[model samples]
Target: MPKFIVSLQSNADYEAAKQDIEKQGGSIVDDSMKILGMITVQMSDQSASSLKSLNSGIISVEPDQEVTIQVA
Candidate 1:
């Protein structure tokens, strides 16, 4: 399972999408307004990929690629 960042489109149902994600075995990692309407969730990649077409509100769904920051 992988985590993803899901962005919602304008005129989209945020709450509906959130509920749908939970219903489909996804856990909301962060519902914070990353960019106003962006939600981070933990779920299988397959589930996240399919989420786009399943929900009209989804503008984009991308894997939360792990990044290692080097601070010197």
Candidate 2:
């Protein structure tokens, strides 16, 4: 199966979002953050439903930012 790299850029609450991601059935393959409030996340591919849910959750946060999702 193909893979996807979901990157969420925000100064939002990563902890809560991270937890939600797992609960939604996606795994965090890698993640890192910088002091300037930039976060990069790489999550494992999950079911379409799960992926949609995860995206919805992230958008719900309404971070003082936006999310960029890319497939690989």
Candidate 3:
């Protein structure tokens, strides 16, 4: 399963979004970012695509990536 970052719209229902993700066979990986309206989930690519399209509260479903910073 691939990991993705799901972003919700402001004022969107968090619980509803969580339920929707579960319905799509996705599991919440990290919800610590929920305060920022973002959640990390682990699921298939198809599930991510479906969730993004079917959920109105979802702003985006993007693959999770690592960011690195270099000190100059």
Candidate 4:
């Protein structure tokens, strides 16, 4: 189970992206844009790969990494 930040093109279709992601068992964690244009989601690596194959508007689907800082 990997989380991904799905970056999409400016002219992306929200409905199409939503449908594809949802169909692949991806859950909507946070949507960067108002609709499904830009979003952060929790999904399998397979799902991310699938999205890239089908969605032309997608810019990139990169794994979400956690960052921590030590304050002194």
Residue-wise C-alpha lDDT for candidate 2, range 1-72, written one tens digit per residue: 233344344645666666666665545554554333333333444442354455333442211235789999
**TM-scores, all models, native as reference:** 0.81, 0.42, 0.90, 0.76
Ranking by lDDT: 3, 1, 4, 2
Task: Give the alpha carbon lDDT tens digit for every residue of 1-72 in model 4.
Answer: 788988888898876877778888999888766454678889988878888887558788889889899999
Looking at model 2, residue 72 earns an lDDT score of 94
Candidate 2, superposed: residue stretches over 4 Å from native: 33-72
Candidate 1 — which residues are off by over 4 angstroms?
66-72
Write the residue-wise lDDT of candidate 1 on 35-70 in tens digits: 598999999988888898875688899889887989
Whose TM-score is higher: candidate 1's or candidate 2's?
1
Clashing pairs counted in every model = 0, 0, 0, 0
Per-model CA lDDT versus the true structure = 0.86, 0.45, 0.92, 0.81
Cα misplacement distance, residue 7 of candidate 1 (Å): 0.6
Q: Evaluated with TM-score, which candidate comes out highest?
A: 3
lDDT of 3 by residue, 1-72 (tens): 899999999999998999899888999999999899999999999989988687459999999999899999
Error of 2 at 6 (Å): 3.3
TM-score of 3: 0.90
Candidate 1 backbone collisions, by pair: none
